[model samples]
Target: MSLTAGGPRRDDFFKVPGKGAGAPVKPGEKAPVDRTAALSVGAFQPVVAAVPMPQRLFEHERERAAARAAGEDATRQLKNVGADVDVALTTAVLLLRGVEHPKARERVVGAVPQLAEAADYRPLDAAADFLGLDHEDAAEILEELTEHGVAGPIAEAAVRVEELRAQVQQADHEQLDELLEFLLPVSALISIAGAAAPLGALTEGDPHLAEAAKAGVVGLAAVALQELHSTEHPNVELESTELLEALTPPVR
Candidate 1:
């Protein structure tokens, strides 16, 4: 009944090896690997960084935006809160006197839009009537005010200035230089008087104006970078570097 020396019919001695759905390997042979079994399939998950973003950038932008908004709110408050007539009128008188007083310039630049709208005044026309000046002169003044972030009336004034400059055809750069020099203090004052956003309004609008504003912005940026490098203003140094990078011309 036995085949060879041992009997094969005993349930205890008979071993049935377990294998996957494929063919089973003999005792002396290596089992064939099911690659599919070894492999895993599910949703593809791309490797991503678990690293956090630098907090400096977010903080810097937030602070700058807040400062700008506060400056805007302050301007609105000036309009809403009725000011003392004597003090306000005295301030207006000082502006018309044509001296480069920083406070006077700030007040005038801010009120320009309101005054112009109320009087239905075209800036070039108003300047010519009041100061006996032409279009080139008016545009120069508009540029000055715009550089200080006195935007709305400043923009309106700029339109009239452009009209006048167009009529003249020829411009006087000498006058523009003179005006810029006189108004530089006012521009600086306005920037400092408000929040910490750099005097950005100077570079707003066209490439031409941006070019003109570049020198001042660059100079200030350089100083800021220097100061920040020495101290801790959170992201001041980083922001300075970003400013420089932004100001750099792109490669063709």
Candidate 2:
């Protein structure tokens, strides 16, 4: 497939007007007229006013605001989920620590550090190394605990943590979709304005139009940057599944 070419280079419009070497004017010479200002005063303002701002731009702003609020809510929910997971894991580990079976108790107690590391978002492989317990070992340990009839609470807690983890992932995906909905239209508008800059300069001989096009590009860039700064990435990897599995007892 053919690749699309890139947009105009930065030098096309961002050049300094009088910085390069040029002949020095005599002291008596008249200053050159600022044609951009002249064009704006003469004819550009009326044409600009005739084309009112599109209603969709307003809609994009509203959607972006809503998405931002939703993302904040999601963040709050994630923190609360983490807190709940901490509590549940703590309770389960405490229960396991009291079990009389030597092998099961040793395995569960040994996994405490790994469980804590996972909860804190450490890499799964790194955390798993603490007890040398892969998922299969975890499953065997869980089965042994179930045979002793002490795994009920741990299993229930793991189920709850898993459910909460699913919710976090879903929220992240939804927030990303909302953010994309806002960005795509704004990006399209910037591309349109950028394309118009050269046409305004070369075809219409209107410095005012060119300036407006440049201003449009700059303004949209600011808007996009502000939104990005204010908003979190939609797919923030919580690494929560690792945490869930770290403490999770196998299903019957």
Judged by TM-score, which candidate is best? 2
* Tens digits of lDDT, candidate 1, 18-88: 32224455688555333222322221011001111222223332443354455643332222111111122
What C-alpha lDDT, on a 0 to 100 scale, does residue 172 get in candidate 2?
46
For each candidate, what is the lDDT? 0.27, 0.30
lDDT of 2 by residue, 224-249 (tens): 32322112222212222232233222
Q: Mind sharing the TM-score for model 2?
A: 0.20
- CA shift at 105, candidate 1, in angstroms? 2.3
